[model samples]
Every structure is written in C-alpha cells, then in structure tokens.
Target: MNAISIKGLSVSYDRKTVLTNVYMDMEAGKLYGVLGPNGAGKSTLFKAILGLISSNTGQVLINGEPVEEQRKKMVYIPQKGEIDWQFPATVMDVVLMGRYPFKGIFQRLSQEDKNIALQALEDMGIANLRSRQIGELSGGQQQRVFIARALCQQADIFLLDEPFVGVDITTEKKIIEILKQLTDKGKTILVIHHDLSKVKDYFDKVILLNQWLVAYGDTEVTFTEENINRAYRGQLSILHRTTLD
Candidate 1:
C-alpha cells in the first residue's frame, strides 16, 4: 500500500480556494520534491496533509489509516525562517521535545529519552553544541538542530519545508546524505524545495504544483518542459529548456 494517499483535497481561506481537488499517492522509501512558484499553496498542502488545517473536501490517509491515527509515525520540520530564534531553549532541550509523543502530558523525560536526544545530535554532528542556547547557533547549525530533533522522533515519514534555505552548501549536502540513508532504511521523505538547479540530482520523484496538482511521478519523466510550463505559466520555460538540455 502507498505510505500516504490524498484524494480530492481542497482548502480555502475567506471563501477563496487555496488548494483544489488534489490527488496523490506517495510511495514509501523515496525522496519526493514538492515544487511550485510562490503562492502555489505548497505550504498549505503540507498543512492539509498533516491535518493541521481542515481540508474543505477530502481526506489524507497513511497506511490506510487517517493521519491523526498515525501521527507519531510522521515528523514535520518547518522552514527555519518561520521560527523565532530567541526562544529560550538549548539544543538538547529542542531535541528532547521529539520524545513528547512517547510520553504522556504529565510525564517527565526519562534518562533514556535524554540518551536518544544526545544520539540524534551526535548523528547530526552537533553533539558539541548540545548545551548551547538555540539562538546562539549559526543558521546551518540551527537547521542541524531541527533535523536532529526530527531524528529523535524516529519517524517513518519526514516532511521538511525548505530546509536548505539560508544553509551553507556543506549543510545542504549533509542533510541530503542523511535523507538518503533514511530512505534506504524504508523511510519516506518529502522536501519542499525551490532550487530548480538541484532538483534532478536530489529527488527520485517530483510533484509540481500551482494551486493544484500539475504533475507527479519519476523526476526524469514528470519534470518535463511542458508540465513545468503549465505550472509556471511559461515563465520558467527558458529555465526548463536550459536545465533539461
């Protein structure tokens, strides 16, 4: 069965439609790139999939079950720019939050949970910054901290929104490597990416969107000039021709 399925999904704000009649079935163990021009409802799509917002007319299922029933199996990393770096938390504290799903509301984090959080930081190559305040870290370091937190969740599906933005090239490479390792272990990863130059190298499958589903499938086949034109209204036609040449 597909790891995630969306059917007739729609969302609206102030009676104006933001997303419409979206349909897709995302398979397991692959890296998917969600692409679109600005205002294409990319973030809205992620929100709908996670059930963070009410969909106007459809459902999202994971492993044949509603998303709420399988919440623990998924982890979402929002764009760094959306966060407040001034939050009074340490790197370790942020990572430990991932274990909250395993602990009830009143339960304190156990030593084992601390251990997992440390391991996650180590895996991300930021163990040395465990005690540092989150706001003190550099942009790349901050992104690593978030990814480490997600790793501590040990989730089957990872949805990262524009993770590479403002990060250094080395950090981007490291993140991609970690994602590939996750897919090798049968995990599903979806990334909201805007860098068209790297799309061919980073994703095996790509979903192109512009307030709706434009195309989705193998990166090589679905990421074509014609489909990109339809989604971008021919604005990126030259880019498509140049990139695909």
Candidate 2:
C-alpha cells in the first residue's frame, strides 16, 4: 500500500522557486532513498511533507490521511550537524523527548516513558552512554542518540536526512541493519543520502530529484544511468564509469 502520497508539491521563498510540481507515491515497508544534486530542494521536499514549511500548492497524505493527522506515525531525523552539540542534555533526556507527543504540554514524562527511552537506547546499542552528556559523544554515538529518540517515538515512518554523513563504517552498517529490521516489522523508512554507490544496496526504491521529480521507482528500474545523468547532470558520471568497469 502507498504509505506516502505527494501531489503537485511546489515550494518557493519570497517568490523564488525552489521545487516545481513534484509528485511521488512511496509504498509501505520499503526503504526509499531520496537522491539529487546539491540545492535540488531535497530538504525542502521533506519539510513540505512534514508541514514544517508552507507550499505554494499541493498536498501530502500519509496512509491516505492528511499529513497533519499522521504526525505520530511519522518521525524525522535531521542531519546531526544541524543539532547544537552544546545543548545541555543527557543521552537519556534526548531520547525521552520523543515521548512528548503523547503527553499534554504541562504533563511530565512518566517512568514508563523513561523505560521506553532506555530500551530504545539499548536497541541502538548506546545503553551505556545514557548518562553521558550529549556533547561528549562521538559523531556515530550522536547519530545513534537521535535515532534512538526516533525509535522511542515508535513511529511507523522514519525520514532520516544524511544519516551516515560522518559516522564510522561499522556504525553505518548497524544503523542500516536496524532500519531493515524496522521495515521487516512493516515500518516505512526514507533516507536522504548523497552517496550513489550505496543506493542499490540500501534502498528498495529510489526517488531521483533535481528540483523536480526526475524518476522514482524500484531501485533496479529507476536508478538507470539515463536517470542518473538526467538528475545529476554529468556530476555523477563517475558512477556510470564505475558501474561499467
């Protein structure tokens, strides 16, 4: 079934166009990768779907319902560099914030919520770092902390932006393993990744964007050399050369 449907999505800032007439239908229980050149409005598309930014025209539906209504089912993990490392919070505190959606603004987090956060940390293999300061962790550990936070939310859809940026190879592999496990349980996962080499290995579907929807479908079908050339415009020619060699 289609877990996400984006139709005619267009976004602009002060009358300057960013994304133009984009459309895509993402299926459930699949790992999708959003690939494009820099400034291709990749992050803009995510924000539009999340209603974190206003769109000039179009609508995003999750599970056939308005995106707003499916907030609990969707969780976004932004780039680790975007987060302030100096934010005086512990690893446990950061993960527990995911439970905020389930409570009133004035309500406090319960012991059960804390337990859920701890378990999420354990699931991410960061249980030992629970009491450590967020800023004191390594890049991979920081990434795991945010991912654990998302797991604590128990959302059915995960939107991760540049998750493997500066992490170690082992950490990246671990994260992918966990993501696949989540998909096996019927959760949908979308990742915004820059590396073209890992797309086929990591995602079942690929959404190639270059300020618009260039191509989107099964990885084997849509990630053709033609589509890559069209979306990346000669910038990814090395990928073709490497594949043929």
Candidate 3:
C-alpha cells in the first residue's frame, strides 16, 4: 500500500527552488531514510507532506486523501534543537498532548487517555521519569518521550527529523529497535538522517535527495556508490571518508 504519494512536487523560498519536481510513492510498513546534504530540501519535503508549507506545483496525498484530512494519522518529531526544552512541561504533560486530537472540542482527557500515555512511557522505559521536567532530562530521554507520545497517539505514519543527533549510543540502539518493532507491526516511518554509515543497517529503504528526487528504492539497490555520488555531488570526497570510514 502507498502510505504517501507526491506528484510534481516543487517548493521554493525567496524565488529559489528548494525541491524541484519531486515524485515518490512511499510504501506502508517500511522504514525509510531521507538522506541529503545540508540545504538539500529534505526538511522541506517533510513540511510539504505535513502541509506546513505550500508547494509551488504539486500535491501530496496521504492514504489517498488530502494532507489536511489525514493530519491526525501522521506524527512528526522534529530535531531536538527545534524544541524549547524549558517550556515548563513535564513528560506526562507532553505525552498527554497526543490524545488531544481524539477529543471533542471541550472534552477533557479521561483515565483511559492517561493509561495510554502511561503505557507509552512504560514501553519506552521512561515511566519513572514521567514527572521530570522536559528540560532536565538527558538528550536520549527527551527523544524517548516524544516517541512515547507518538505511540500514545497511535499514529500510522511517523516523520522524524534527525532523531539520533546528540544522543548516547545505548539510546540510539534502543530507538532503532523500537522503530523496527513498529515496522514489524506495519507502521510507516520516514526519517531525515545524515549518517550514511548506518543507512543499510537501519532502514528498509532510502530516499536520496539533492534539491530533487535523486533516487529511491530498497536500500540494497538504491544506496549504491553511484547513486550516493550523484546525490552528494561536490561533497563526495568528504562524505566518502567520513561516512564510509
């Protein structure tokens, strides 16, 4: 099944093109790594899919419906740097926000919602930190909280941006394990990632972008040296040494 479909997608900023004529059909129950250098429009693609940005000439469909109609079915976890960690919110408070989508306009969260949030925390091995301030936790713990929130929401598609940055090795392993488990249960996940070394080990497929859809398919076939060279272009020498070391 196609979880996401993009056709003739083009995005621009200040009269400059960011993503040009992009088209892709992402399948369900797969983990996809969105890879490209800085300013490659990787984030822009995510924004377009989430309806956070308007495209110059294209459409994004989620589950064969428009983005607005399917917003609740998707969960986006941006980079840690994008968040205000000192927002005076507890772990539980953040996780509970996921349930708001399913509530009536004036409805208050019920015990069932709390139970679901608690279970999400427990599953992430952070039930003990439910009362901790969001800013006080370590980077890894903070990432886990957001994943827990996604679980609480029961979203079918997940869009995560640079999720493994600034995290401990143990936490990275834990996160990949959790993501694989989600895929096993038929969840679709797309991650904007920079680490090329872990591409094969982590994702079932990859989307290589460089202001366009350079290549996309099963990792074994699409993440080859030729495609990577095409995608990275001028930074090949640096990326090859650093990523393939």
Q: What does the lDDT come to for candidate 3?
A: 0.92
- How good is model 3 by TM-score? 0.95
Model 3 per-residue lDDT tens digits across residues 54-100: 64689999999999999888999989999999899999999998898
Off by over 4 Å in 2: 237-240, 243-245
Task: Show the lowest summed lDDT stretch of 10 residues, model 3.
Answer: 236-245
**Which of the two candidates, 1 or 2, achieves a greater TM-score against the reference?**
1
Q: Against the hidden true structure, what lDDT does model 1 obtain?
A: 0.89
TM-score for each model:
0.95, 0.94, 0.95
- Once all C-alphas are superposed, what RMSD does model 2 give against the true structure? 1.6
**TM-score comparison, 2 vs 3, better candidate:** 3
Estimate, for each residue in 1-245, the C-alpha lDDT of model 1 and write its tens digit.
Answer: 99899999998988888899999999999999999998888989888878799636898998789988988888899998888889899999899989999998899999999999999999889999999999999888888888888889988888899999989898798788888887898989999998888888899899999999999999999988788878888667565568765
Give the Cα error of residue 59 in candidate 1, in Å. 0.9
Residue 149, model 3: lDDT of 93
lDDT of 2 at 46: 84
lDDT of 2 by residue, 13-132 (tens): 888888999888888999999999998888998888777885469988899998779888888998988988898899998999899999997999999999999999999899999999
* Residue runs of model 1 more than 4 Å from their true location after superposition: 237-241
Report model 1's TM-score to 2 decimal places: 0.95
User: By TM-score, how accurate is candidate 2?
Assistant: 0.94
